[model samples]
Every structure is written in C-alpha cells, then in structure tokens.
Target: MDDVTDRLAQLERDDEELVLDHFDRRDAWELGHRLAHVALERALPVVVDVRTPAGILFHASLPGATADNDEWVNRKSRTALRFEASTALLGTRAEHVGFDFFDQGWLDPADYTVAGGAVPVRVAGVGVVAVATVSGLTSADDHQLVVDALREIMAN
Candidate 1:
C-alpha cells in the first residue's frame, strides 16, 4: 500500500484500540504522563489534555506551548467527541471532500474544527466516554503522538 494509505490504516487501528481500552482517573494520569514523557524526550513543545465526556481529567502545557494551543486543543477535542473519531482522520476526510465539513455539515466554525490532535477515548463495550488531545505539532504528528502513547500504555 502507499504511505498515505498505510498511515490511514494504522490510524484506524489505533482509534479502535484506544476506544476499546479501559481507562479511569489513574489510567488517565498515567497516559497523560506518558504523553508528556515522550514529548519531552522528543523535545516537542505541546499541550496535552485528557477529559471525560463529563469533565477534564488531566491537562499540561509543555515548554513553548501557548494559549493559542489551548484553544486549538479545545476545538480539536470537540470535533473528536462529537464525531466519535480522531481529528486526524476527520482532517484527512475533509481534505478528500474538498473542505466541505463546515458548510455541508452545518457545524459552526467557532465551536468545532476537524484539525488533528484529538482522539476519542473509549472503552470496550462502553463506547466513547472521553477525549485525549495534543496540540502544537503538525496535525498528523499530534495525532500520532497520542496514538503511539496509547499503544505503549496498552502494551504494558
């Protein structure tokens, strides 16, 4: 398969896995720390956030992250939760459809955005109950950071 196709497939797998994985406050803390650790190791300046449908569980802003990054995180998280899909996937789909998400979908541009970095946090047989988000990198890179951290968290 082509690189783009392969990347999409991997993202699909990751979305499914992350959705099925069980999580609670403890898990949220662990996952958040793990994300931060990796970002620090890579020297990536970013903001990480984890939240349940009901409330936020964790949030952090690393070096170089800005208030604007926090706004993007909110927008991206809303997109993922509303659609029950990763923002990265949504971004890709929007590009394929010629950027019609706002006009065609009847969603307000101010409230929701299909940018990358936000992913639905779900549990097996429970469906999506939270959102995990990172911002400050390219869309693909931000999405991959969360996916990679979740993969590592689930493997252990």
Candidate 2:
C-alpha cells in the first residue's frame, strides 16, 4: 500500500481484482440495493448508480443527496466506464503525473470527471461492461462505498 505511488497502485489492483463472470440488470439492481442499504446504515448522503453503455440499470438517491450528486454520478460513471478503471485511479494519476484530463481537451468536463466514486464493472472475458457509481460523499468515501459493496457481493 506504501509504494509511494500516491494510492494509485492499490486502486489499480482493485480494478484488476473486481472482475465479474457476467452482469445484467438483475445484478445491477442487487448491487444498487446493497449500496443503498449500506449508505442507510452509515447515514450516508449519496446516490448510487449502476449502468451499462446503453442505459442505466439501477439508481437510488438517499435522503441527503441532491441533483448535484446526480450530476456527479453521471460524470464519474461516464469516466470510469469509458476508461475501464476507477475514477479514483484517474484522479490520482492526474495528481501524480500532472496529467490534467480537462487540459487535454479530449474529455469534456460536462460528460466526464476523474473524481473518485465510479468503478468500472469488468466482466471476466468481456472487459468493462458497465459502471457502479456513488456520489455525495467525499470522493474517497464515495469510491470506497462502491468498492466495498462490490467486494462483498463478489465474495458471496
């Protein structure tokens, strides 16, 4: 964990390990519900989302969340699903490598963000097929919730 990579390497490991055999709308619903339930237990204000490239499969907004969180969900989810990695990894890369995605001019801030919270849902053979995202908490916290939930669900 202390490779001096600014937490980037561990996040990359998470992406490497959190792979699925298959994912569908039912899986998304289960994941969304699990995330919501945990958020409730922690009294977290957040929006959880699960979606594929075509459309969203599941979404939930906890009480303290707002439309702004929804926007974060959209941006973070898009970034993760598009890049096939966790948003946190992107953010860390930006910090360590001085790579400003916004300055690159390839990614529009309106559609994508490197902030933590969204994680790409990768299938064993198919690669990334969707994304699971949380918004409203601090970026790291938001990212952790989704990662932890995915870890539990995958474990079971």
Candidate 3:
C-alpha cells in the first residue's frame, strides 16, 4: 500500500501544476482508454468506469467482460466512495464483516467485494472520483493492472 501511495504522491507532485488546476473530461476519457488498453494488453478482460462527483463520464469494457463484471465495477466504485479508500480496503472490510457483511447491512450490496481490482481516483488531495474495475486475472493482478494504467496516464 505504501508503494501505491508513494507512486500516487509522486504522480500528484509531477502533475501538480496540471492536475491542481483542473481535471478535463478529455483527459479523463484518455486515461480511461489507456487503462482499458493496458488491461487488454494483459489479456485480462476488463471494464473501466470513470465517475466524477457528479456522475459517470466514461465507461469501457474490453471484449469478454461480462455484465456481472460491469456491475461489480460499478459497485466497487461506489464502495470506494463510501469508504474513502481503495476497493481493496473495502474488500478487506467486507471480509472482516464476514459472510453476514451483506446480511448485517454493514455493506452495501452494490459497494462490496473481495474480488479486488477497483481503485478511486483522487485529485487536489481529495478522492473526488473513482474507477470501477473488473479483471479476468487474479485479484492482485487486477489491482496492479489498474495501478499500471494510472501510472501511464499520469506519465502523460
């Protein structure tokens, strides 16, 4: 997690001037496309959903991604928003909450998963958006793919 944080911080610092000033819709779309492309390159079917404070602005799913995966991605984004953490953290919380996490009502049916692969997109030191995620690879692989995608986006 420290690694991810460090990378994110570095990206923020690198893009500080550009990002601090604004987040453009075109940039978001370009980022989403780059992310999806990375997923495809990995041979993992993936769905990328970009959501701002207002609503979803971009969504893309590579071939072989299912409707279920799409739903998972959407829920993952919502979970990120509710927890103010990455979807991985939400998944951990769900595990701690146990099988009844859903039953106990501590988890939102649309905002919980142990499957991994989702991440929140933050700017200006605040998590103002999220990227819904689904990957055909292992959960860790999925997460890494998203991280790689984000890195590539920031590099640009």
Q: Score each candidate by Cα lDDT.
A: 0.85, 0.90, 0.62
Residue 142 of candidate 2: its Cα lDDT? 92
The segments of candidate 1 whose C-alpha lies over 4 angstroms from its true place after superposition are 1-6
**TM-score, prediction 3:** 0.71
Residue 44 in model 3: lDDT: 62
Give the candidates in order of lDDT, highest first: 2, 1, 3
Best-performing candidate as measured by lDDT? 2
Tens-place lDDT per residue, model 3, 1-156, is 655555445433433332222356876787677777776786667777777657887788788888877777766776666655565555554454354547768776766664667666656655345554555666666666666666666666
Task: State in Å the error of residue 116, model 2.
Answer: 0.3
Output the lDDT of residue 73, model 1: 91
**Pairs with backbone N, CA or C atoms under 3 Å apart (clashes), candidate 3:** none
The TM-score of candidate 2 is 0.94
Q: Report residue 91 deviation for candidate 3 (angstroms).
A: 2.7
> What are the per-residue Cα lDDT tens digits for candidate 1 across 36-147?
8888888899999998767789999999999999999988988899899998887776665467788875888888888789988788888988888999999989988988
